[model samples]
Target: MRYAKFSMDDPFISMAEVRALVEGEVHFLAGVALLPDGREKIASRSSTVKVSGKLLSASHDPKEVNEAIRGRCFSIYPDVILGRDKNMFRALYSEATKGVETSKRCPKLDLVFTDGVIVAGIREEERDSKSLREHSMKPFSQSGTMDPFTSRLMVNLARVRKRVLDPFVGVGSILLESAWMGLDCVGVDVDPSMVTKAKANLSHFNYQCHVIQGSVTSLNLVGGFHVVTDPPYGRSSSAKGATLRELYAAFLSVSAELMERGGRLVFASDSREDWRDEIRSAGLKTVSTHLIYLHKSLSRAIYVVERG
Candidate 1:
């Protein structure tokens, strides 16, 4: 088994997003998760580690903790450092590795502590936040453009192997991240200016993505695409002469037709209307929904839907 440490950026949303990315059973424990081994590569914006064992209900005694680390470090090479939730516990590092380093292997063991519970493991994968930030701050940015981390999460949630489509790609935030993940991305925007800006942003990052000025409702694109986008929320952005409900219904209706069978659609919106009927009527199934509380009076809902 492996333990995955999640970013505290809305743990509920993070957990839900991670659940969609990872296969097999996943059990949650506070801010950490126990995932099946060999399935760690699918993790994005989260760190996965090989779990050696756990010190359940650990006491406050530092010596006992050091002893536990020593026992688990017997097989670990190139030394093992004491870490608490991805942060190094330098005070205990010396004590934990008194004589553990007996080889020259590069991989080190990480002992993660959450709520006084210690989980010994080796760090395997984590998201590149620095690059994500650089891509998000493009030449042109808008108010409702999706955040870089959330964009990556949505793309990963879609589980697209090669390509993704964004019907409402404003400034190309989602497309940028999608291309960074080595996926071919295409985006369409109703406004010509927004389309130009999106194309420029992708070019600035040297990502060859396709950005077109067209309405999503009338988009006649190839089928078999995993659609992931953040539709305009009707605030700080135009709804294209349609109510939020009607806009979503039309988008879902067309997206359902474009996406391949079993292709997933992950979108975020501020609309509170239940889209179950509209989603089902469009030949799609609602996989899951997550409410992200941004602040007072503004919470966004992330919907995960799949073509049936």
Candidate 2:
């Protein structure tokens, strides 16, 4: 689909990270909505600009240096990058004059990815080619889940018109993500510590959340909830009482009972075993599975499960 990308408005923001995620120009221009590692809040969005220059005069004149530099080379961007401010250019140009041959540096308006053009904000070698998926065993800051991850999750919910639920609502990762995205969220967890943490985090972010401290099994939920969770993985579990297998089984059983006719569950989990087939047999239909890393053995499996 040839969608027009709008650059974020903040001329000084960093476009290095977001640029690597998608193939081309950004959906929004100027200020890009950025989701850094472990960030709950996707910060103000920023646009990207790649500038190239050559030292001149004494190999120092801005005009001569600028003239000698490759013009269209700006289009040949690095796979990994950042967009600097125009004000930042002065110091940069000054630095280059001092016998420092900077291949690429400084911010310029003429050079940018606008109108849906896919530019290399970062070069291939700089990017981690392993498919990157944003996740958290615990939710960020609490309120609204407005990052790229939550945005995508909400779209699925809205498209299916299915009420979303997060069974392992640690600090409200999934629920908070869904709620602020304008989807109804139902969260469950046995840990009182998590429930409170989730609530506090939600309040701090100023986003709304509907969470229960009861187990998903006994909740006897009404209506239907599409489950989505980031279950505790490895040493990240605050679930001191149960094994990883038991936690997953609870999720499997809950999906069988609470999900409506077309409900879905999208969650991240640590594998003690292949859980995809287990979830399917538990009355949920498997959709797609994406593998993501959350540190070491905590390799997360992002599952999209739908009710049969």
Candidate 3:
């Protein structure tokens, strides 16, 4: 549905994540757009504009914009007008309510202008970053723990309502986020210390998840899980004697076997090596790829793959 203007944690990652989660038509507008089957997903949770109309000219005066907004809000009978900031849209809101009586509480007409385009709609939802932050601050966190925002994004991108698996769960970040989204989660790690810490971390959040200490390649897990993981990487990674590519190839090969038909896998890596051959050999199809630049020397490649 239509979304309001809000700062994304990372626009590129958010866009890619939304595309992966949404199953139908998607259209990008000025400050909002239409997304199919994403009403309940996290990708839609940050949106403020619930219902919207066609784009309007950014140069339109307050009166003209208000008239257009009034036409869109006719069915809802919004009593309050809200803008993204106290700038042009605020003037528009004031002008719109000049001859109108304000209600104590009613539907709100929301406006957002971006890149010479104006989007008008009705307000619906707001994101709670505070609660998300609280959940992210587990008692036992480590350097490798995934950030809550990205963890939640990855879980949503998986688009699995039933179950999710993180084969390289570090401190239970992915598992915790999946459980927070009301999905049954399982996490496997080769390090017993990590597994124990992950379990404790989940407990601190009062979340229930299966945390096991086992190698991802040898784990006897039941098929049918949407997997999302950030495997061990870098010079300090616990890859034993194998190269990064070799470890990734082995994990993907076994992951393909552990996934149900049509299951999706979301992976992240910092390696600059090309993995097209490894991905194909693992019997998975690449759905999308995104690159996130963390710093001058560090960039991550995110891949969304589907089991064949």
Candidate 4:
């Protein structure tokens, strides 16, 4: 079995489970998760996952861990724990490997204690901090641009089959994540300036994506592409003279048209209303909804829908 440990105390932590499910079949217990083995790639690229590894053992007794890890060449690495005693787990690890032989250079083992479960596993993948830092520091940025981790989460939620489309792409925040996953990317914006900025940002990261200056309502493209976008919230972003309701309805209609049957679309909105009417009208099925509190006055609802 494989397991993932999520960052604690994040308002977006709730989305971690959904993201895990979207990427692979996994079960969440508190902030720690157990996923089927052979999902190293999925765990590596996930925004919410901190560390993932092959489980060696999960038991209260350190002898079980010691027995499972005997004769294995590994170094003990303690990961940050949530809702558990860190030093206790460290001592447990020390006890488990006291007499066992290990190699300090490669194949490290991570000790994770959370929700009263003790897990010892062989470390396989970790978050790419350097890449994430570079993506977050893109040359062109705006006030309402989605944060890098959240942007990546949106893309991951879509589970892009082949291509990704961002109808309200602003500065290519979501597109960059899609590009990082080596997926074909197409971005459209009503504002020509935003279109240019999006292209520039994508190019800055050495990502080649198709950027078009057009409204989602009038845009046309081949079907079967997954969609991920964060539409205008009308505070720092302009609505282009369309009400939130109208803009969202149009967005849904266009998305439904472009997506093939069973294609996924993950979109975000700041409005409190869930847009059930628009979703039903567009013949889309609601898969799930995740609420992320950005600040005191700004909470965004991320909706995952499938074209039917």
Candidate 5:
């Protein structure tokens, strides 16, 4: 399990979200070239299964990355992202916990390090750098949002071939994240604007995706997903004006359809509604639950759920 753990780029919150995103796995780490949409990012979509052939994984602890890739040829470079401050080189070095200095001119990372310490740097053409800028994002935009949190999740989804579904695909944020991570994402949304917005957002990054304007209860979902997680806002969307009992029933049905046998199903929802019965009816068992503060109005709960 050499998967990488991507840290949530939220300055206000700690790396706990990132830790949960990878389920305590670390292999590699890279700060995004961009800061994501300047809005609140719930989670950093990450690749859970670390594929050896592709040679990439999720890692949050810089020490873990340093220890794992110590003897191997490595390069630590920041993406020449547009919106982020040029000072990210320092922050990334700090996160890597390595006292390394990189210039602003170089974009693609190409270098070699000794004991997590940078010995020398190289240009894009230098070293064994396989310069593949095929997925470069378009100009920065404040129109849609995607912080490091969602991006990490998307990458993890790219690592496997499974039913990738998002129940509450508001503007297809997670879908965009998954697409970049190299996975085919299917998004279900009730709002047509969200579908359009998702397409626009995906187009901004020059990505192709599948978006469905529909409800979660009866989603056009085909197969089971490898990892299914979404920030369900009852107070705002699906749960609005409905009783807890009614909401849970709806969630149970949708959740069940989203997962396959032994598929990892993680969902974040407000605790205002009871989940005891829904957990059972959905044929999913609770693994862990954490209290999260999603602003003041909504109470956030991250539940590690699995289909049994």
Candidate 6:
């Protein structure tokens, strides 16, 4: 079995997105999720799933936890971390790892306590360039620009094959994450200023991607098997003189043309409409939908669709 620990702050989105990415049966414990071993292979490109590795052992007793880590190579000492319980697990972890051996040339070990159990596993290191915190200062940003973590989460959930397309790319947040994952990226925007800003933002991070100043309704390109974007909904930017319903309908129609068969599309919208008619008209099937409540008046909906 392999253990995947998620960030506790946003458990709903984290669980939903990861469930879409991985295959096979996944059992969710308190703060960690267990995936069937050898059936899943992720490149470790996630913001919510912080740690993942082969399960070494799971136990409730302190002595059994100590026995589980016996003779394991660790750089310095294993760090005990909490997933749920704070006060009680701290002392139990302290007793479990007392006088443990460590080496300088070995991987670090982490003990995660959650749901009244201690799970010991080797921590997987992530690529620093793909981190969202690296580029805190963006060249251009709007009021409702998607954050790097959420943007990358959508990209990962799209199940990208080779190339990624963002039809409503604003400042290239989604494109930046796609490029970092070593995938070909193309972005389009109706506003010329947004096109320039998106290019600048991608260049600042030393990522190469194609950006075009065009509307999604008339986008004349193909070969983006995965499409992820956050469209303008009159909050951060205008819909370029089109109503929300009209923009969404046109965008979905063009998206069906740009994508190959079985291609995946993930997008965010604040409209409460279910979009069943638009999705069916475009010959696309709705795979899943996730709703995130931001405030009393606003809630964002993420839709995953597949071209048939």
lDDT of 6 by residue, 108-187 (tens): 67677777788777666332434687654678887778888788789977888688899998888899889988999999
- TM-score per candidate, in order? 0.79, 0.51, 0.80, 0.90, 0.53, 0.85
Models sorted by TM-score, best on top: 4, 6, 3, 1, 5, 2
Inter-residue clash pairs, candidate 4: none
Candidate 2 lDDT, tens digit per residue, 231-284? 666544434476766667776887768777766666665544478667866877
Of the candidates numbered 4 and 6, which has the greater lDDT value?
4
Instruction: Write down the worst ten-residue block by lDDT for model 6.
Output: 75-84
Question: Which residue segments of model 4 deviate by more than 4 Å?
Answer: 11-25, 84-91, 101-103, 235-240
lDDT of 5 at 110: 31
Higher TM-score: candidate 1 or 2?
1
Model 5 / residue 31 / CA error / Å:
16
> What TM-score number comes out for model 6?
0.85
Q: Whole-model Cα lDDT per candidate?
A: 0.71, 0.47, 0.66, 0.79, 0.47, 0.78
Model 3 regions lying over 4 Å from their true place: 4-9, 36-38, 41-106
Model 5 quality (TM-score): 0.53
- Model 3 has an lDDT value of 0.66
lDDT of 6 at 197: 96
- State residue 236's C-alpha deviation in candidate 5, in Å: 6.3
The total number of steric clashes, by the backbone 3 Å criterion, in model 6 comes to: 0
Segments of candidate 5 deviating more than 4 angstroms: 1-146, 150-161, 227-232, 236-245, 271-274, 296-299
- Candidate 4, residues 262-289: lDDT per residue as tens digits? 7899999884777888999988988888
TM-score of 2: 0.51
Q: After superposition, how far is residue 152 of candidate 6 from its true place, in Å?
A: 0.7
